[model samples]
Target chain A: MGQATEDRGTVHTVGLGKRYGSFWALRNCEIVIPRGGVCALVGPNGAGKTTLLKLLTGLNRPTEGSATVLGQTPKQESDYLAEIGYLAQEVPMYKQMTAAQHLELGAHMNKQWDGQLAVKRLTGLGVPLDKPVGKLSGGQRAQVGLAMALAKKPKLLLLDEPVAALDPLARVEFLTSLAEAAADAAGELTVIMSSHLLSDLERVCDFVVILAAGKTQLSDEIDHVLKTHRILIGPRTAETANPAYTVIKASHAASQTDLLVRLNDVQFRSAPWHVREPDIEEIVLAYMGQTKTEGGVQ
Target chain B: MNWAMWQQHKKQWMIFGGLIAAFAVFAVPTGMHFWHVYQQALAGCAAAADCDQLADQLFRHGHDANIFDITKFAVLFMPALLGIFFGLALVGREYNDGTNLLAWTQGVSRRRWLSVKIGWTVAITALGAGIIAALSTWWWRAGNALYLSKFQPLDFAVQGILPVALTIFAVVAAIALGAWLKRTLLALGILVVILLVVQISVPTYLRPHYAAPRVYTEQLVVQGNKNRDHRPDQAPVPAHTGAIWVNYSAVVDSDGTALNWVNPPEECSYTIEEASTRIHNEERSGGTPDVYIDREGGPAVHFRCLKEKGYHWEVRYQSADRYWKFQIIESVLYLALSVPFVAATYWLVLRRDA
Candidate 1:
């Protein structure tokens, strides 16, 4: 309760874990997502991405450790839920209800619901607010579901795979509206969108958290990750040890060696090797792919 | 939130409304006709002094009793319909469609959400069941007076506040199971079984013991006394008309020991009456004489012989005067039974992960 206002608006988790029956869905998970930015959570399927989102929203209780979302324990604080908005996978709205009725539900159940904002966002994209959600197109339903999450005027909005099922055109529209909403919020709202796909998030997200096999492999600003990690192609040799940097992945050919490394210094210039800037997708795939071969299977 | 619940359950509300409308269609007309016949019968028979005959004429001899029978079934079915439509679908459908993540994550906590849902649905069920029970209670008045069965099991469930209480119990139980199972179809199946078991077992096991039955004692005539018309078993105990007979076969002795442990004194012995025997005459067996066999009286001499040993009959019964008291007690019991279910649903929704 005595924490500063800015710290309270951030999502800070420490050693958070969840187990189902005998299997742990997520363990030793730690990430702190700063406020006022769109954070992309990328992982392979079943990488505890959804689990982490649920934990933050207090939809799930962690089996071990704790999380403070918007300065409150999700399961403990009565007002904690009001600060966060969550949309589940597949965009689960009441299919039997019209989008307008869903908005009305939001109005009735939420104290700070912005019905006009949601209506404007949806109607701008030609989403039929009066039709039953079940009868809407897939992209339209996704927009309505997003409107429901956004209309609550939450400080932190958690969306699980919001654009995974949309067509290219619809995906563009969904992202366009989301970016517009984020811009409109003026840095008061923080959005975390989880997807296994990296390209869509790469374009829209400034912060990135990469999870693999129920553990966080990387969490940082996308620009920082891109700047600090690099691929170096050098002549092959048996000397693998290096104090200049840490290698994440290495492969050797007959006469050439390639190394993906996190540099000890982002400005370190390499004269003996040709260095290339890594794409965000390449960095995320490296993290996801590295864990797969090194016992990610458990 | 109240309006949200209605919007969510509008389809079920419509279906339940249709069910109640159907009940009204059947009950209103039949009830008026029944009341007319009953009023005319009372007015006609009051001067004619044929009340005994009229009781049989109005109930035991016509299709009029079927109206009461149908209404009884309707009363019994209303609660189950509420359980299925409102309770089973409340949370189970949300879980089925994955909408709980949407509903529970809104600006309200799961506890508040569930309480509003349970409270509103239970209130509606009680109100609807209350109206049906009241209507049926009014309708059964003619049958109650004519047939004198308001104290019986079939009539008791349909007559009083028990319907409202039982309906609350049904919906709460269904909600608990629905939350626990998280599947509407599965919850519906188990809820039907649970409601049936509780409804049947509670009455059979619990209702009879609510009030200690009156220990009605009387003595059958002793054998070898001045001839008694009819057999001793045919002797009717002195009880008010329409008093429910719980048990009529408990026999005891002067010292108040049950007759179950006593063997016959080298002769026939029974609880309500001594067993009779048939005596086939050795000589008159050839002629057709009143069903071809000579019938001898029951061991009336033996019951007199038993009376000589100081034995009597005890009947346990609930008099009809306690009907309203029983209604109150049972209603409280059912409402008590529903509290735990409401608690369980509360705990599951608030504590368990979605």
Candidate 2:
């Protein structure tokens, strides 16, 4: 096995594009994610979030541009794949193979497997290793996939909706175990996960990269995104529209109006509309809605 | 990783092994009876002045002479089923099971994956064919010894070897077909069609003529006078009598002219005198000679003469040039078919939209 390095893991894609015949799934998307922190890639369905992850993982190639994982081209440097753990969106598993058999196969094939860690995780999760994967419930299967990914002790982890099939409790437990595993791995674990469940992302991700219509709407530290973005509610008749506030989006329901305003707007004042701190969910939904208005949803 | 792949295919391998075992067990006894009958026929022929007479006697006595033929027929037919099964399952099972995706994602190059598959299939098929050939050969050894004196080694050689070789060839062709088709049922159908076409066509249309026996007889002419007899031309026209019976024949020329004869006449004219004499003899002696007269005696005729005069006729049997060319064309067609299948698989696997 190669010695682990201390360099921060980074994913960089420049003008990355994907198209299926006449329809473009993603186009000219440029984004850079810094290492050592969880980045939540949030988007509506068909926003090309899955495509970007696949391109980054080397499962698919871009049509126009290129992507780099840890400074190596994903397609060219498949050896680097060993250092990255990926849980595909569908999580295809050998249904006939038992959970233990799947793990054994993974251990045999993966260069970074830590058997003890996998056993401990499976045991803690109460997953019966001997049970056939097809016989297991959807949540159980997802747990098995997670255990396999975490046991690899990867430097980078890319998961596509890992908990989409799990129930609420299992989803929480899976994410909690993931966070603990990341911490136990000494923060060398850099994870990039896409999810429509913004709450789950908000719970586990430290950074956020919002994608809409196959383009990056915004990407920044979670804290910074939440702090800089605010939801304002006030009277529609209030003629005091401040110049400091950039009204990212404004929608009226009944008499009162709700405005998702960027705090960076120079005209924004501490007076008038009641300003409330926006959570990650609001931030993601705002960008999604704005992108939708700019370009109709795919 | 290799072991894991093998384990994944273990059940399939076991099934193949069981099939081979069953074939061996069923075939051994029948094959042994075939060898014993052939051995007795050869021994009887050696002890008699006329082998054909001995063959007639053996046949009349109902001495299980058909056992050898039956065994040979079974040997020819049984392996074709094995070939079809092996070919149909080689790659189709993996694609059907979706385990191929797992292997592909596990860092195994697509080329390597395909190579392993083809390698394993060819190796196992070859092994099975070899075992069948060996066991059949062993069981037929006694019959072969018995027929040694009655039949030429060449006859025995074709009887024993050609069917097995053909069966193996069909199996290989089936593998290529299955790989190209990507479906077991379709591949098997194509294989059966090919086998049926070959079996039905080869016997009637392409049977080699020269495989039959040759008989040579000459007329002794006692000239009317010693002086006239002394002259070569006056030596009663030196009547020659012979019959060249051939099942198939061919003539090849450097100028790209080729002629094939299937089931040619028993006797042919060698010269003008022979032709006239053959007609005369048919009228007078009631025996007609089938002779091919080459007036030009060009390279084409000369080549035909050379081949017909050879010891082993089938070795020079060139009647099926068109069929051989068709086989080559089919090979190219199979190669062409593989391209789209491979391209489609790669395209689906690496498509940008997943």
Clashes within 3 Å, all models in order: 1, 23
Residue B289 in model 1: shift from native, Å? 15
Against the native complex, each candidate's DockQ, computed on alpha carbons, is 0.65, 0.18
Candidate 2: tens digits of C-alpha lDDT, residues A4-55: 2123237777899998778788888887787788899988888988889878
lDDT of 1 by residue, B1-354 (tens): 677888898787778778778878888888888889899999999889866567668855547667566668978877887888788878877888899888888877777788888988898789889988988988787888776778778788887898998899899998898889976577888989988998888778888888888777777554322233423544345455474636444556787776543344454343322232221232255532111101132222345555667777777767788888899999999899899998898888888888
lDDT score for candidate 1 against the true structure: 0.79
lDDT of 2 by residue, B92-119 (tens): 5545554444444444444555556555
Model 2, TM vs. native = 0.67
State every prediction's TM-score relative to the real structure.
Answer: 0.88, 0.67
Stretches > 4 Å off in candidate 2: A1-9, A76-78, A235-247, A270-272, A290-298, B41-118, B133-354
Cα distance off (Å), candidate 1, residue A216: 1.4
The number of the candidate with the highest DockQ is: 1
Docking class of 1: medium
